[model samples]
Target chain A: MDMGPHATFIWTAYGLSATVVSALILRAMLDERRQRRALARLEAQGIRRRSDVAQERRG
Target chain B: MLSFATLANPSFFMRLTDRVLPWLAGVWILLLAAGLYMSFFVAPADYQQGETVRIMFIHVPFAWLAMFCYMIIAVSSIGSLIWRHPLADVSAKAAAPIGAAFTLLALVTGSLWGKPMWGAYWVWDARLTSVLVLFFLYLGLIALWESIEDPSRAGRAAAILAIVGVVNIPIIKFSVDWWNTLHQPASVMRAGGPTIHPTILWPLLVMAVAFSLMFLWLHLKAMRAEILRRRVETMMMTRVSSAVALKAAE
Candidate 1:
């Protein structure tokens, strides 16, 4: 019960563990989104490079 | 039937992950909130244990998830190594750290629980020793993957190790049961049924589900990042090669 002295230890452990897990999950998701965006940008740049090459060859 | 290659497409997998991650995150948050409230406010504390019994709320669920995470890695590693499933490698890689985290959590919380109940922080009992072995197994797998230069080869090697390590899972689970140990016997998963009261059982189960969902969300995100990292490296290499060719022409 909340009346016991050891209740603090139990609560502290649970709270800290939950916070750590949540932070890790959030950090992973954010990093993934950033990587995805960077890849998309690189893909677009590659497409631009190819189009420029095709135009130069035609000219 | 869909072949492994179809599942291996990075874009296809990304789309699936996008849809799944949000739902998993949302459910995890909701369940965590609800589970905590139930555990702290609703569930009656043990008559004998006072509040020390409350440690079981986190410890038991984490122990379950630690084993569950290993199973995920083992299964994914098999798919990658045997079937050459590309996503499987990334999934197995991402899951290693998360599983290691869970194992660490279980061990630490179990120790904290033991201090008050057992009048000591730890015992070299079979149950405790086997769980410690499980923790080391995760670390070994992580280190093995990191040490190998070739990704595919690493995946195959780790897969073999994981497959062999499957025997340890049962040993960890049944160690307390098989041998007389200071650790209590299985209360949640048993042949007859869970002996714990429903109020306590409900929160524990919810927390377990929340933890599993959180792991899935993170694992998929990590896999996506890993694939993008590979793509970026390939692009950089291509650009470097072209630049070298231009300098040679000059």
Candidate 2:
């Protein structure tokens, strides 16, 4: 679509916003993955979440 | 009390968010796609502003969300200080950078829109200055959190700063009306009903919802990551303590 004279301003706003939001989502996803791995490593060493321990006690 | 109890349970939260996250992601995508379509193709150009008016779709929402995100930080700060909710600080910490990013966008977009209309990119006026201050406030809170080594202590300090910085929110909102400024006064939200035509208003409102949902999705993801980071820290601490005990015995 033709955005006329102010197309630059309009497109820039949309482009920059998309970039910022995508970067944040990517960072959050990576961090979540990293943390999950850390938790898994601990679990491998016999450390588990409190809920898991309580479940074991009940079982 | 009941809700707080449920929210405080980490495993429960992880499970709950896990289920809801996909829904949030889906809705955000659907809404954003619709909003963008209406924004560019559906909405007509303004008689005065022309296609530049199209910028309002995202700009207004960013400005609105900037304030809205800060409000979230303030409320989470209250939770941190008063109820001492386990995840309160986590929520507050997760929201800071997101709020800062939105605020920065608001300022930049405001400037871009302004330059085309006002003949200047920025001016030291009430609305503009207050938002700039809001950006600084976000930076200050993030810095406060990082500088403190202990998580609990850092959370408390950042909570206080978040609480104190809330005074800026109102000033930013009312600056256009309260003081003479280059920034245009509120068009959609005002004493009377919205002044803009329905053609533009609908897309702007839809865009607002889309942005808010986007923020919610991001905030939840950030909070999840933070919880994991803390878990990792705790695990590291436990390992260090165990190693020290074994060495001491030797």
- Weakest 10 consecutive residues of candidate 1 chain B by summed lDDT: B230-239
Error of 1 at A19 (Å): 4.0
DockQ, cand. 1: 0.43
**Global lDDT for candidate 2?**
0.88
lDDT of 1 by residue, B74-144 (tens): 89988887788778888888888888888888888888778777888889999889889889989999998
Docking class of 1: acceptable
lDDT of 1 by residue, A1-59 (tens): 44487765686677778776877777786877787787678777662234336768999
TM-score of chain B of each: 0.94, 0.97
- Model 2 docking category: medium
**Each model's backbone clash number:** 0, 0
True contacts kept of 2: 0.67
Error of 1 at B128 (Å): 1.3
